[model samples]
Target: MNDFPWLSVLIALPLVGAVAVALLPRDRETLAKQAAFGISAVVGVLAIVMATGFDSDGARFQFTETHWWIKQFGVHWALGVDGIALTLILLSVVLVPLVILASWSDAERSGGVDGAPPKGSVKTYFALILALEAAMIGVFAATDVFLFYVFFEAMLIPVYFIIGFYGGPQRSYAAVKFLLYSLFGGLLMLVSVIWLFPLSAKPVGEGGLGHGTFLFTELNTMHVDPTTAKWLFLGFFVAFAIKAPMVPVHTWLPDAAQQSPAGALVLIVGVLDKVGTYGMLRFCLELFPGAAKWATPVVLALAVVSVIYGAVLAIGQVDLKRLVAYTSVSHFGFIVLGVFAMTTAGQSGAALYMINHGFATGALFLLVGFMIVRRRSARISDFGGVQKKAPVLAGLFLIAGLAGLSMPGLSPFVSEFMVLAGTFTRHRVPAIIATFGVVLAAIYILWMYQRTMGGPVREGNESILDLTAREKWAVGPIIAVIIAMGVYPQPVLNIINPSVHHTLARLDRPDPAAKIHVAEKVAENGARP
Candidate 1:
């Protein structure tokens, strides 16, 4: 088992499942759906196994498998995971099966806003979803810079079709917008990728005399001029910021989320968007530490703006899906801030926040999807006194909402607190301003809940049914993880800390408190003299 190719298996399982799904008889939609779910479930189990076996104390990459793929271009099919990548891979795997179950009935429903008819085959829908899963796993697992880029761009295809074919009236427009934004960012990254190749061509230990290679380990050893490094950093950072959907570049997310189906939205928001922040930690910061430190002030300002702006916008949203999307913008701000804070606690919190946000927001989106399915409307005004008709659903919604607002006993609260605490150690004013976002979070979540679930029963909502068994199964795990993580974060934090420490070590920035302690020791020594 120790020598097994577990990471390869994790990546291959989903790709194989996708092919199997696509080959199923066109009319046998049920069988295709079942196969997709089974494959994703197995992948989820494998991820759990990987997590359980992971050595929390080790900061080095594990389960690594590297093979030269395009030797001429210095590209390799390299894959590996540290605690950071492993946790994200787990989040991606865990969400896929739940997404399949959550959208099973939605897939069967008549398509279009007017109940015209199904516009796409169920077989293709599930198959595309499975394919997307494969790309996500590949993205997290890829240790070669070029291989990561391949997976990064490859992810857009399945999601594009999912949004365009299976989405709402504005599906085409939203999908196009998403593609355009992503493609623009990708092009900039491609230029950076090409520029980095010459730097890697030199021989190992010969300053810059290694054969050109895209392996992260080799690339990390190659140094570039400071001016050149900053430009490359910007190229990668812009691409990731768009994907992270941070404030200004974030415009596409609400539109895309609004038009996409529930399951697709889960993967889009929960897993795919994470690639941005993950890239910043892995590539931008590690590959260009001088540039990262130089750009910190500007980046921190944008992060603060994202926090306040996204929360304020979320409070004004009338569409439930759109509201969830806006809240993500705000949440992502915290993750970015933590990453840029350049502290172990900050990075660890950012990583943990990514996992917790996935579950918390996933529940909110899934539940909102359920409500939309029941009422055939995404408008907040379409719901009233929903708790009277579906107490279980309302209760679940409250829990998810509370988690989003960082209520003391939920998972997000723990991570959010750590982010702020860490940020204050290095940056006091930005952290203080960012705190206002928390207040706005409460206003938006509670206000939305009160209007939709606590009011007098609307005429049509009285007959809306409670969650079905499948819905319960889908949401139950998310809720359980949320509470468990909030109460006992040590397990995940244990895994996250080593990776965070490793990253901070690479950046070589000292903690302010550590500096202060050193100064105190110097004063004591002087007094003794």
Candidate 2:
């Protein structure tokens, strides 16, 4: 298993599938959809196989593979997964097939983008999904900084077309906005990555040349100066925060979500957004612990602001898709909060939050997409009393909505609780303020559900249909997983906790000892006598 190229195979399968799907007869949309779904499913299966082979108690990075790629610059074709990356990789692969199934007929339904005919073919849309999957997997699996950057940048092209060519009337605007924000972030990261090569080769006394390696393992050992490391950290952090779509830099998300189809959103907001938070865990902190600590106060402040800001903004949204987007901005806030809390539980919870958010938000996007298809409108006022006619659709939407609010008995609740609990132990003020996000979440989620799914059957909603069999197949598994994981999250926790410890180890940080009030009082007085 160690010798096999698990990551390489996982990445290649999707690329090959995309090419094959594209090469098929252009007019056969149904065949293209089926082929895309089948290929994505196979990749998902392989990802599961890879997961089963992972040993939680074993090496920090399992199934390792390293080969020199750019010897001149000390880069390598390195690939591996720790618990953190594995969960995210699994989340990405698992969602792609479901997105395919949910999107089976969506491409055909697309209308002109702002009166301009769609530029891409139906098969091309399917092909892009496969291509995007390959890039996504590569980004998470790449241990080499250069390779990661390559995949990171490559992901934008497919999404650009998906939104600009296949989305709503304002899709052109939204796609361009998404692209520009992403490009700016990527440019900063590129500069940071470029600087690393030379730093790695400089003499040891000058904080360099630990065998001139760019492998993350080797790079972690270098002793860079405070000023240089801080600049590098900021470069990477800004790129990730934009990707994390944190406040100030997070404006691209709602616009993009408002225009994109639901299936594309499943991966877009659900998994793709996670790369930002993941990079914070993987690159920013481990590589520059001093800067990370320096930036913690500001980072936590912004995270809380994002939580409250997103939820409050969500309350005012009339568009269903855009509402869900704000909620995710809020959710990602929680994930980031747990991460920088510097507690084992906090980091683990953040990682777990990434997976749970994917399931919950993916389902919400798909279900909302279904309703829009029925009525050809994404407005909250356009829907009412849908449950009377389409109980199952309404039911699943409600479940997904509840999960978004971190309702108990759903998977998100466990992760959200862990994030808060872990953060409270380390940073009480931020954790307390962030708790209000839960209350605000209930307002946004339930309010959106009521407006869209709960009223007496509105005039146009009378003919609304329940989910088709294929739609159920697409969304049912996600709901079931949500409920099951919420009930018992230990299995996933086992995989995530070790990686959290490793990250904390990089910072030389440890879980704070429990503070007992009784012991403190007894010590103050001479004991009760």
TM-score of each: 0.95, 0.95
Whole-model lDDT values for every prediction: 0.88, 0.88
lDDT of 2 by residue, 1-529 (tens): 7778999999999999999999999888889999999999999998898899999999999988899898877879999999989999999898999999998877777642234456678999999999999999999999988889999999999999899878888888999999999999999999999888867664666654545666788778777889999999999999999998899899999999998978998899998899999999999999999999999999999999999999999999998888999999999999999889988768877898999999999999999899988988888998889999999998999999999998877888877877887788779999999999999999998888888778688988888889999999999999998888877777888898888888899999887786433322321221131
- The TM-score obtained by model 1 is 0.95
Clashes of 1: 7
The number of residue pairs in model 2 that clash at the backbone is 1
Worst 10 residues of 2 by lDDT: 520-529
